[model samples]
Target chain A: MAHTGKILVTGSGIDLTLLRPLEEAGNSIVARPKLLSAAELKAELRDAVAYLHGGEEYASGDALSTAESLKVVAFMGIGYESFVDVDAAKERGLRVTWTPARRPDAVAVFTLGQIIYANLGIRNRLDERYPPQWSAAVPMPSELSAQRVGIVGLGSIGSRLAGLLLTIGCEVSYYSRTRKLAETTLDLTYRTLPDLAAWSDILVVLLPENPSTVNIIDTSVFARMKEGSILINTARAALVEPVALGNALRDGTIAVAAIDGHYRDESVNAALMREFGPRLLWTAHVAAHTRQSMAAMVDQAVRSVLRALDNAPDENMAVGQ
Target chain B: MAHTGKILVTGSGIDLTLLRPLEEAGNSIVARPKLLSAAELKAELRDAVAYLHGGEEYASGDALSTAESLKVVAFMGIGYESFVDVDAAKERGLRVTWTPARRPDAVAVFTLGQIIYANLGIRNRLDERYPPQWSAAVPMPSELSAQRVGIVGLGSIGSRLAGLLLTIGCEVSYYSRTRKLAETTLDLTYRTLPDLAAWSDILVVLLPENPSTVNIIDTSVFARMKEGSILINTARAALVEPVALGNALRDGTIAVAAIDGHYRDESVNAALMREFGPRLLWTAHVAAHTRQSMAAMVDQAVRSVLRALDNAPDENMAVGQ
Candidate 1:
């Protein structure tokens, strides 16, 4: 109990500056930036004071069930679906904590920018930009002022995104199991999932990925949306049925799609490129890579690990809350 | 004037609707869409009603100066820079009419969309999406409400783009020689070019590609721009000095640039993309490619041709004006 060991940040691509307090506390720090898959972490499970996980897919059940010396597991972002094996961690006397994902103002701005550009065909134009030299820029665009936006699962991030849209003059509406106390200036209207689908010119998926939320935007949702309406899935790819989204895009039911999650393969982007023709605007899963947010993310993650060491639970992120 | 002869519509990718009305006007339309390259026209200039010139580079003087029965040389879009040996056309008694470009509402929407979206970085996100991925968008996205947009030319399209930005709550400013008397609530400040550049977050160019406009966005203007500002050129690539633009991007004097011109090849886009790296966004010269705008462009060209044939002199667009 009196032995001093290093805090090893596993899998999460957290920045090194976050371990400042721990370093100052005179503890050694080991950080593996890449998100580690289950198949690769059998050996390193035993020698860590704390570990931070990344993304929505990583293994913790088998690793946690046996790693007797593992004291804490800290999830930096809200999504702990990948790293949290609560029952297993709890049974093994290990503590878990997660810092709920905040909207990260920069990400919201980026989203609004994407909606304006994609709807107006800005990204598509670049895809078609002439090779070697471009003489002119042609924008095939629609107006945000003219469209209705439906945001699903209006949690912290979604609500923040909604506020940004309202600021930009978009008619913002939301569909959530619960509502929060928001300013009326936001002009946010709450609707059922089905009604939200029918009313939106653009539907944004901002809720976390889970079993119940899988295929939330199925064929029926596509059919309900106004023809040629857009779908922006920054939430999770599973929220949108890929086949349904594809069918909608091909038939022009959904005119264009901009996704930040759910497909990172070249084939997917290439298929989308071919199927949507110019209607699809693809960005390679980089919706959240702002300089500010990254720095913040790394700082938040490292802080969470230190709090775990002090045995003063991370107040912001209740362990397994 | 009495003889009914087959009319040849010369120009590759010439909008068919422009010539479609010519057929409806009781003329036999012999359409040959060509790129004005050496192989096609010189080989068969005899098989020509009018020789329609495209918006790219123009034909040689001898090609047009020596034509015997090329009675009508119709220049497709606004700038007659593409065609018209005016002295020769007058000497031959052949009519040369330039369809004055009307900054169509559709084109304006496209321009606004690109301006907003380029700043957002949508294309990179959507194409790059991976299921269960995390990344930040832009670190310090310039807020639209907080921005001062400077329009270099207060001509038809420039003015319209300003209006659209105004509708989205952008503080619009301009540097036009003449005063724009548009009804608006926008704080449209009429400033000098250097002042406008200094004061604005985004600068849009919608000037004619002329000697005066060539290299207008040079070092002086770029230096005047606020650090980390976005520059948009939907008018002409020549407006930007490629080297200056490249240097600004490298030095971060201009944070990001979205250009729609300079499409001899990918040099402009590539240079910006390389020097700027994840900051610059360029498109193949396609800022006015909406369904409505394309139809409007074709309709305008055809109507212009018809009006010239009917002897209705549009003195505003005639040679002197």
Candidate 2:
């Protein structure tokens, strides 16, 4: 029946229609399109059953301290690495859930698209101002089948991306925290981070953002990469140092860099623009924002919230399932 | 033991080293990197046994008449369609050879890249001018898995393109010259040109250039296309009319157009720039110019020329074989 408890929906890009199920289940909804600070959320918190989260809004111990009536907090995105304080939620005996490995298809597709873009030299080949005249202006793009692609993280998105690249005849290797059991169907090799960088013509970053990954791809990593190699980052900005990336692009340490995620700080974008200009293919964190993937994620998040309110067991909810 | 006849190499983007087999086979080489006119080629045609062609160099009845010692004319690129005077060469008893369907891999890869580009809305997603504020400046791109794609002319490149699209979860249908016997492995449907246009969210052109295909994608075809559907062309310039494309893009009959081939006449480029500008993803005719593909083509062309000089049968010299 009517669950009378209020649901605080906080996210910038989630479809509101997804919350209609919660409303139909008889819960009142307060949707916040922009991320509010912990103190601001605390001030507005009242008789809330759950908080459906999106964006970079923090749920720190101090914030959770004020969430007196909060039963659950669920994220509509895959990563819950740096964005949320899971420890704090656990301390308060509050359940925290996130759509882990959600939208891998969208992210993997975006990564594959960037790989195609760089390998085909689409940016240089398609510039209208300077028409490519074959050998003179447009040298042939490197074939995908001939290039070695190295991915930093062998997570869900990375594994899916590897499968896609393998379909296109790309040789795939990855560096993850642990080695996956050999799949006879996949011609994938596991390598050390430095070895992967040295061996690859194109290095892709898809690591989750955490203390260990922050500034992981620094000058040292860039120095190890092959000369005129390309770097593509669709992961978090914390994984790459802005100044080092800019320097690498300028000094030709890397031929081109396609970056999708950033720190949500304008200065980072401005710095990349000032240094790389058209050389840097930048997208404002919309890689996982495809119509189908986004809808699936929002549905997952909403269902998780509803399940939590119904006092369903924790085993019942997981990301994208 | 040696074929001492000279070979005239003409093309803008050919890798010269591919002709080494001809030299090894005892043929002298005279390469003119620029496209030579009928009169200009006539002046240089003395004692030439083969014409290694590239670009739009015409070997007319008059030109072939002047090529007194010319036994064969071979092209380093695919499509001997409108560029070569096949009838004139046949009448003159001159063997006409081209690397037809030679670089289908390259073209297919490029088409896949363009498909990813249009489906992901990469141009708008990556535009730095309008800072995306999530669902405002940049909405979620259409999913590759969710879009219905239509291909015109399911020839070599188109069929290969179809396979790649299928790999990435796109529903593919095509209007080819003839139906490929139902392939259970491939989830492709055969459709009439008009029906395909109406049914698609994206239209791709990879038709070979011929009298029937010239200006085939006119205003009527665009009129039939879905309102927000995208169009991609990496085939021949003659397949789609430029003015109709511009009008379609302007009137919202199409959402985006990623074109890689066009009439060498700069007028088409100028007009598209004037009308669509950023909306049109324009690339010079470099879709089939991957290093591996180019090398394969030039090798085939030179070998064809050498074989013709050696009095080999014409049956073995057909293109795309």
Per candidate, native contacts kept equal 0.34, 0.50
Q: Which residue window of length 10 is worst by lDDT in model 2 chain A? A: A312-321
In model 2, state the lDDT of residue B85. Answer: 75
- On residues A179-284, what C-alpha lDDT tens digit does candidate 2 reach at each position? 8653335668888988988999999999877778888999989889887888999987668988888788888888878888656566877877876767778876
Best TM-score goes to which candidate? 2
lDDT of each residue in B1-321, candidate 2, tens digit only: 435678888765677777788888888888786657679887776679888877556566777777778888886565665767777777777777877647577888888878888877787667443224566545667788778999998767787788877877888999987887533457589898999999999999988776778889999999898877899988766688878987898888888888875566767778777768777788767787788988888878777877787777544364322
Predicted candidate 1 versus true structure: per-residue lDDT over A15-62, tens digit per residue: 456567777876777766554556555455667666766444454678
Sorted into a CAPRI-style docking class, model 2 comes out as acceptable
- Chain A only TM-scores, each candidate in turn: 0.83, 0.88
lDDT of each: 0.64, 0.77
